[model samples]
Target: MSDKLPQNRNNEEVDLLVLFDYFGKSINRVINFFYKIIKGIFSFFIYALKPFIRNFKLIASVVLVSAILGFIIQKTQRDVYTSQMLVKPYFDSKYQLVTNIKYYNALINEKDYAQLQEIFNISEEDTKQIISFDIHSGPENENDKIVQYDEFLKSIDSSRAKNISFKEFVENRSIYSGDVFQIEVFSHKKDIFRSLEEGLNTTFTNTYSVKKMQKRDSLISIERQNILSSIKQVDSLQKVYIDVMNDEANSNKGSYTTKDGMSFIQERTKTKEYELLKESMQLRQALSELDAQKVEEDVYFDTLSSFQDTGEKYTSIWRVYTLIFPLAAFVTLCFVFTGKNIIRFIVNYEA
Candidate 1:
């Protein structure tokens, strides 16, 4: 048994050596594969740079001429000015407001200066200066978002509400979901914004919004009449309860003896006048709230902030073509060289 043990140990050592050799070869192959990928990427980058390196002078001249042309255009174009107004619309008038803003943009695009003149009540020359109109939701804090989310949850089905989280609700909400909106107008004339406000003001009172407002007022009137009637009934019941108690006190009879000579204890009656009073107070409070709501939202829309008399000069990064032209020229040259090389490769290729 001792003699066989050494031979067995030698065979085990040989097997381990073979396994280690196989693993080392596999690791070497993986390393070689990654190395080849890195080398090929570096070679391709150098090849791409060769054309730009060889034709540096020509590329520089083209880029310089394009930059000069862009600078000239930038200097010659008319300057733009922009102004903003904030508004809170009631009775879903925001829908009409957004629609009107789009209509204004369309009119501007179509260059219907005559129609624009009628709408804004401005001269044809002033209307020609108008560039664009835009509207988007105004700023709101987290608490406002939470309140809106709660309302949205209540407005939908309970099963669907369970699948929606607060973050999801906020992310999915549209511009019309907001209660306030900011209207922006762009024009070449700095003072043109103030004149556009009158036209914008007319946008919030469409036929739909008018009917909705009337319906709300009618409902409030009905509710007010019902609450007043309830208060009157409660008052009458209270008066009857008071009279009954007063009469009982004056009777001076705690217990009465029957003809059988059996004396019975008198059981005083209980009145829920206190509960009735609480109900009356609650009803009155609800009625007051309804009146307050109607008073606050009577108008079609409220202007939180009006447009400035003179708009500020507007600038955009996209308008800075002095720097843009040179970059664009470089990219265009790269594409041209790449195409030339491909065509040459195809012509010289031997299938």
Candidate 2:
């Protein structure tokens, strides 16, 4: 029995060993398959490079042609010149003390659209060409302030005026606000500066007129309020006096001797009431006059603000073209180079 037990144990051990060898062989097969796949991919790359390796002359010719094309593209394309203008924007010192002065001034006294178009040498329809009028306030850092100022300057129009492009408007839009306001202008050439300068000057001068109109409007509003308050007070006084006279007349209606004193009191009250009523009427008239003045002032202010805004926008319009043209040129060059290289590579490989 013991001998048979030993023989059975040895047989079980041999069987376990055989199973382990079969599992190892399966793993080896998978590794060999992956290694062959890796070798095949490496061989494909080597095969692909065979053309470039076998034809050194062709490769050199292609490189030379690409370099020459790149040089020509770099040279023949016109360099986009950028000119910048700086501006400082100023708010009227009395802007806070006086409300809507700038707004009203622009509305009331500025030239009409036709006159502005003639002055700027532009058609009224061209006004829409103006894009941005960004106002920046109080940058803490000097460099940042200058950068902001430059950005503001770039926001104005840069179209041609009287056969010249408008680059001068940037410097012309400068406002004095003790480090607070700045304007910058950008253009392709310096020659446009004079025309831009003139346009900006005219536009800003008109803007000042709008500010004045706004101030007038503010004053009118104050006057209107004062007149309204006075009218209300006079009306209240008249009502009080009338009420007192009515009470006196009612209390002494049937009393014989006492009626004389009551009549005298009522008479005095009636006269005072009439005087108050007349004063109230005068206040109302004054209020009406103030209202008319306010209307006029408002109209003037609106016109001025609109004109100034339009002029500012007109000066800023050129930045768009300035930004777009260079970028477009760069993109065109990139596309040309990439397309040429790709087509050359494909044709050569196919051949």
Q: Which candidate achieves the best lDDT against the true structure?
A: 1
Instruction: Estimate the TM-score of every prediction.
Output: 0.86, 0.32
lDDT of each: 0.93, 0.50
Query: Model 2 misses residue 245 by how many Å?
Result: 29
lDDT of 1 by residue, 67-122 (tens): 99889989999999999999999999999999989998999999999988998898
lDDT of 2 by residue, 190-226 (tens): 2333443445443333466577767777887788888
Q: Summing lDDT over every window of 10 consecutive residues in candidate 2, give the lowest-scoring window.
A: 301-310
